[model samples]
Every structure is written in structure tokens, then in C-alpha cells.
Target: MPPAQTTAAPPSPAARALPAARRSLAPDLARGVMLLVIAAAHAHLFALMATGTDATLFGTWDRIATGTMTLFADLRGYPMFAALFGYGMAQIHRRRSEQGREWPWTRKLLRRRGLWMIAFGAVHVALLFFGDILAVYGLLALVFVGALRLSDRALLGSAAAALLAASAFVFTITFAAGGVPQLPEKPQGLLGELALRLSMWPFMIILMTAATLFPFLIGIWAARRRLLERPEQHLPLLRRTAPAGIAVAVLGAIPQALIKTGVWTDVSAAVGAGAATLHQITGFAGGLGYAALIGLVAVRIAGRPGPIATALAALGQRSLTFYLLQSVAWAVLFASYGLDLRVSTAAGVAIGAAVWLVTVVLAELMRRADMRGPAERALRRLTYGTTAAHGRAD
Candidate 1:
């Protein structure tokens, strides 16, 4: 009898893509969808504020919608962005080392990126929304440069610790202060709000720094683990993670939902506000879970392109452009001089979704034309110090 032959199994498409795939369409597709969710929350808040209504019947419906929005808001976008940022940084570091270049240059490049982001974010906050994230992300990226050399285990441990400590600190401070601080009894005029935001800059830096860095570390860790490299290897992890992520997200949301709905009395309000820290903690956790789930889905859907993924990838590829565009559109629609729609809770959501849909469609069209979103094109020029190269915009 002929000797039996043994063969190794072929690499799954996702596994084959591995490290290279991090820069491919998958992560960008996830980011594109996640950004829409972020936009929806912001837009909805602005729309509701503009409407200037309380929790009437319509308001009640809005609250329900807002509650749902909160789930997505709390668990989407930022973490994924942070993670991918970390992964990109690592890849850059790896490429540099392979090329026998000194690593400090990468740090310098990241610092420049951070500064650019800060400048961009400042303009965004001043002209658009005060809640802009780029400045925060930029500053946090500067901080993460120090952490780049840490092993994956150290990165993960440090991230987890920082998250827990930050959550506890926020909760303790808010509780000791007797509640979450408000903008004051009277609406601070626009200038006043701007002043208030500036006043809170230190705290904002602290909060956002912790929030951004930890997720970034996790992303670095994910890259090191080849989690994105082998989606099937991580599927079991996702199955366990997704349910827990959803549960934590729901639990974290319950107190905030109750407070927003007026179901919690003063005593409960105190308890719930303290518990809102859990919301932030779980929100981050849930965000991680969702990222894992998306990765798994991407693996399954690899080599089988769908409209949704294609559209999302386009948006993601041009994320910088879309991100800036979102701020521009929101400012025109919601700022004091524009539509002046300051609608707070529910209505903000509806408007946000509408804006996101518009942006997505426009992005898709732009991709078809082989044109990158203007902001993205500019950023690429700045980052690479060269004219744009030909490829899908994303």
C-alpha cells in the first residue's frame, strides 16, 4: 500500500491577510459604521435640544430612542478607533525596525500627528461642537508613545488598571461632589459654555487621556495577539465576550436611563449617578466586545463583499475627511448662528441619523469617482508629504 499522505490545511483568507489586513478594508468598514453611530448620538442630542421640549408623549418616544442610541453611543467608535490607531502605530514600529531605522522618528511623527489633531480639534470645538474628540485622541496618542515598548501582557494589564482607576475616580469625585456637575442653573451663554469647557480642560484631558489610551493599548495588544490575523482563533473569545459586553452595557445604561426618564427619585438619583461610572466602564468593555464581534463577522464575510461593508470601507478609508465633514455639517445645522437647533436628547438622535445617511451616501459617491474626501486627501499629503496615490479612497 502506498504511504498515506498528510497535508496542512490551507490558511483561511482572514488568517492569510493577518497583519497586512489591519490596513485593509475590514477595520475601516467597522470604523465607518461606528462613526455613523457616533454621529447619530451627536445629531440626535442637538436636534432634541433645538426642539426645546420636555418628556411629553413625543419626548417619551424620544427618550426610548435616545436610550437605544446610548447603547450604541457608549459602545461604539472611539474604542475601535483607539484600537486601530494602536495597531497602526505598532505596524509602523515594526516596519521601521525591519528597515533598520531608528524608532524615535516614529515617535516624532506621532507627535506631529497629535499636534495636527489638536489644531484640528481646536478649530472643530471652537467652530463646531465642543465635544470634539480629535484633540483628545491626539493628546492621548502622544502619551501612548511611551507605552509602545511594553509587552502585550503589560499593555493589557495597564489598560485594564487605568480603566478601573479612572472609572473609580470619576465615580468617587462625582459622588463626593454630590452629583454630576451641571453647566450652572442658567444656560451659560455660548461664550460662557466655551469658557466652562476651557476651565474643564484639565479634567477633560485627564478623562479623555485615560479613555483613549487604554483602548489604544488594547488595540496594540490585539495586534500582538494576531487576533485580527486569525479571526477563527478569536471566535470563541468573541462568543463569550459579546454576551457579556451586551449585559454590562445594559446594566451600565440602566441607571442613566432611569435618571433620564425621571423614574429615579433623588435618593436613587444619587445612587444612580454614582453608578453611572459603571456605565462608562461597561461601555468601554462593551465597545471592546463589539469590536471583537465585528472582527469575527469580517472574517466570515471575507472574500464575500457586501454593499454595507463596501460602503463602510469607503467611509472608513476617508474617515478623516468624513470626521471633519461631520463637524462642518453639524455646525451649520446646529450652531447658534445656523439652524440653532440645540435639541438635547431624543430629537438629536433623529437628526443625527439623517445627517449620517447623507454623509454615507456622499462618501460612497466620492469613492466611485476615485476621489478621496477632501480632508482625507489633505491629511494624506501631510502625513506622507506627497501627492495622493491612486487607489480606492478608503
Candidate 2:
């Protein structure tokens, strides 16, 4: 008699989510560092809101912080995230394809994830913060998931068009208005605040989409080449991008920074608008350059990352959790019903850095314990199923 035979079960869809050891260090590291830049930028904006003046002009340290942030951090942070988001999208698609999943099914999965993210953004705005980017990226995913199937030339062409359109829109608006738009007044009560946030959310989504779409497309292009994933294979390109992109970003930022810091207060509207247009365009380079530079760092520390590198990578792996945590901190610290601390730009920056450091430590602890960030876990469950979500990385 022949012995009975049984077939092994197939791997779950969620199993395709990159495991910790197998995940690329560069993308995660860039994300962790980008959070710091985001924190500084937001902190500066909040400080400016409170002061009702350009916070950069407050003091020597404030001037230094603001200029540094504007040059390297301000518009830089979100674009990096946008590119990374595109990269992640491609990653998911690639994994699904390798698993023998068809394009239509994968497309549905991506859309489902995007819808959940939009829900998450709504909750975030209602309870914690107003400047929620999750929804913006969510909408991007919902709209552009098809781009994953696009040819490289098509992707690049679309990105270029989007970039030009965004640049033209910014230039036209600024030129017409003679300056950037002013921040809205902070509403009084919790209900009023919620209303204001919700009201502003749609407008923000539109603006952020325009600003982020180009990089998001560019990210898809990079992912197709496995740029970040296989940094060693593309050393020459990364090397060239790092310095050239940063240099362009810095030069483009100088005029805008000077104006904001009051050094060029008497400049005409045309000059101010032109400076803004240049900043907007160059910011894309800055963001990509930062990512490229981080990729080089990852190559140098490839096999054995030190303690700090390990911690930062951990935070990056669980970025959604830490990012939301930062929002909660901001709300508690500055909400009208909360402490409402209106510190200087320098102080705000210091506080933001401190908050980011605390997250780093917390993320390191979570890494040791082999715990997924609560938000990441939830998102995965929503995206895949309970079985697949059990042990997944973002």
C-alpha cells in the first residue's frame, strides 16, 4: 500500500510584506530621518502661527534654525515621503505579482489600503491633528495605482507634466497675490477647531496633491530600477544626485530664506514670487538628494548597523506610529483646550527634536520586543487579513 501524501499550505498574501531582515535599510533610514525634518518644519510653522510674525526674525538662534530648516527641511520632508510611498506601492505590487496574484486583484488590494488610510486620516484630524497627510497619500494611492502598470517613459513623462503644472500654479498664484497665502485664524472651542480642520482638509488635500504628485511618480520610476533597494548597484547615480541636488536646493532656497528672515524685507512682489517659484521647483531635488545621501550611508553601514543606525531604522520601520504620536504631542502641547504652549521657533525646534528622540528610544524598545507599531498593525490588518497581518513590516 502506498503511503498517504499531503500538500503544504501556500504562503499567505501578508507573508509577502517584506520581513525585517530582508527589508532595505536605506528607505527605512531615510524615513526615520525625514520625520525629524518634518518635526522641525511643523514646529517652525506652529511658532510662526503663534507669533503672527515670521518666527525666523525672533533671534539669532531662531534665524539660524529657520534658515537651516527652510533650506534643507521645509518642503523637503513630504516629497521624500511621497517618493517612499510610491516605492512602497511598487514593492507591494511586485510582491503580489511574484506571488502569482493578477493585476486586477492587486489593484483592488491597493485601493482598499488607500481607503483605510483615508479613514485613518479623518480620525486623526477629528481627534489629534489637522495637518494629516495620510489622506493625501491615500487619495494618491486611490488615483494613481494604475501608474504601477505604466511604462518607464510614461511614468517619467507624467511626472514631468505634473511638476510643471504645479510649478506654474504656484507661480501664477503667488504672482497674482503678491505673496504666499496667510494662515487661517485658530478657532476657539474644540468643536470650532474640529470644524475648521475638517473644512480646511479638502483644500489642503488639493494643494498637497499638486505638490506631491511629481515626486510620487518619480518614486515609482526609481522603484522600477530598484534604486534604493539595490543601492550598491547604482552607486554612481546616487553619488551624483546627492551633492548636485542638495546644492541646487540650497541655492534655490537662499532667496526665499532671506525674505522670510527679514533680510530682504524690501523686495518687490515679483521677486518674492519668483523666489518662491524657484524654491518650489528645487525642493523636489532636495528631497530626492536627501534620500540618495541616506542610501549611500546605508551602503557604508550595510552588514552591521551600529546602535544609533539600528534605532533609527526601527523608527523608520514603524514610521506611521511615531508620526501619529508626534501629532498627538503637538495637539496636547498647543491646542487651545490643552497646554497651548507658544514657545519661540528655537524652543519649538528643540522640543520637536526632543520628541523625535523619545520616539527613537521607544521604537528601539519595540524592536527588541518584536512588536509592530499599533497603527502599522492595524493598517496591515485592514489591508490584508488577520492571518497575513500577524507579522508584517510597512
Question: Which candidate number has the best lDDT?
Answer: 2
- TM-score of every model versus the real structure: 0.84, 0.95
Number of the predicted model whose TM-score against the real structure is largest: 2
Q: Under the 3 Å rule for N, CA and C atoms, how many clashes does model 1 have? A: 14
For model 1, residues 1-394, the per-residue Cα lDDT tens digits are: 2122311332222222223134555567777877877788667656655555543335566768766765657445566777777776676565544444455765776677677777777777665565667888788667667777887678778988988777777677667766543322212357754664465566666666766777788877776665765667777887787677767777777776665555554644357557667667777777777777777787878877688777777787778788778877876777565656655566677777777888788878976786766765554445545533332222
Give Cα distance to truth, residue 62, candidate 1, Å. 1.8
Q: Across residues 1-394, which tens digit of lDDT does each residue of candidate 2 receive?
A: 2122311333578666677988899999999999999887877777666666665358898888788877988898888999999999998888777666777878999999999999999999888777889998899999999999999889999999999999987787777777655667766678978898889888778878888899999999999889999999999999999999889899999998897777778767688778888888899999999999999999999999999999999999999999999988888877777787778887888888988999999999999999989999999998888976687774
The whole-model C-alpha lDDT of candidate 2 against the native structure comes to 0.86
Question: On a 0 to 100 scale, what is the lDDT of residue 331 in model 1?
Answer: 66
Candidate 2 C-alpha error for residue 167, in Å: 0.3
How close to the true structure is residue 250 of candidate 2, measured as C-alpha lDDT? 94
- Candidate 2 residue runs with Cα over 4 Å from true position: 1-10
